[model samples]
Target: MARAVELATVLGSDRVDQALGLAATAGRFADDDLVSILEHIAASKPVGEIVRADEAHSVQSGTIVWQALGQQPTAARESTGD
Candidate 1:
C-alpha cells in the first residue's frame, strides 16, 4: 500500500488504480508483481510516430537532384551546346 502510493505520486492515481485492479484480477501480490505489471502497461502504450506528408513540392529532395549530378553546370552546357 505504501509503495503503491509512492508510485502514484509519479505515475498518477488512475494508472496505479488500473494496475492494482489488474494485479488483483491476476492474483499477483508478490514484491515485484505490481512493478512488473506497471512496466508492462507503460511499455504497451505508444510514445509517438511521426508521419510526413507526401505532397509534391520543390522543397522535397526529389530524384531531379540526382539526375543533375551527372550533367554539366548551366554555363558549361551553354558553351558546349550539348
Candidate 2:
C-alpha cells in the first residue's frame, strides 16, 4: 500500500493507471483494490527532491511490490533495431 502510494507519487497518474490495469487484468486484484490505490494516489503529492533522487528506485521497488501482489509482467518494448 505504502509502496503503491510512493510509486504513484513519483510516477504520476498515467503509469499508476497502467499498473492498476495490468494488475486487474491479471486477476491479481479487484476493482475495489484498484480504486483504493487510486484514492491513495489522488491524495498524494510528490516531494520534488525525493522524486528526483529516487524515481527509478521507486519504479523498481514498486514493480517488485506489484509483482508480489500478482501483477502481470508488462509487455516488453520492441526495439527498432537501431
Candidate 3:
C-alpha cells in the first residue's frame, strides 16, 4: 500500500488506479505484468509539469516517514527495453 501511494504521489492517483484496476481485471497472468505497468508509469515523463509547493512538501515528508524503497528492477526493465 505504501508503495502504491508513493507511486500515486509521483504519477497521480487516477493513473495509478487505472493501471491497478486493469491489473486486477486482467486475470492471474497479470501479476508479473503488474510490475511492468508500474514501470511504464514511472518511466513516463510528467505530461504536465506544474507543481504546487505544498504538494512537493507533502511528498518529501511522506517519503521520509514511509521510508519505502523504490521498485527499481521494474523501472530498470522498462529503461533497458524489456
Q: All models: lDDT?
A: 0.84, 0.61, 0.68
- Model 3, residue 26: what's the lDDT? 68
lDDT of 2 by residue, 1-82 (tens): 5666766787786867666876767675755666666666557675253444465555354454554465434452334334
Better of 1 and 2 by TM-score: 1
For residues 8-81, write the lDDT of model 3, one tens digit per residue: 79878888786787677865234456567777767876868786778546745455635446545566778899
Encode model 1's per-residue lDDT on 27-54: one tens digit a residue. 9976499899889888885536555566
Name the candidate that leads on lDDT. Answer: 1
Better of 1 and 3 by lDDT: 1
Per-residue error for 47 in candidate 1, Å, reads: 14
Candidate 1 versus the native: TM-score? 0.52
Candidate 3: lDDT over CA atoms?
0.68
Off by over 4 Å in 2: 29-82
Q: Which candidate is the best by TM-score?
A: 1
lDDT for residue 74 in candidate 2, whole number 0-100: 47
Off by over 4 Å in 3: 27-33, 40-82
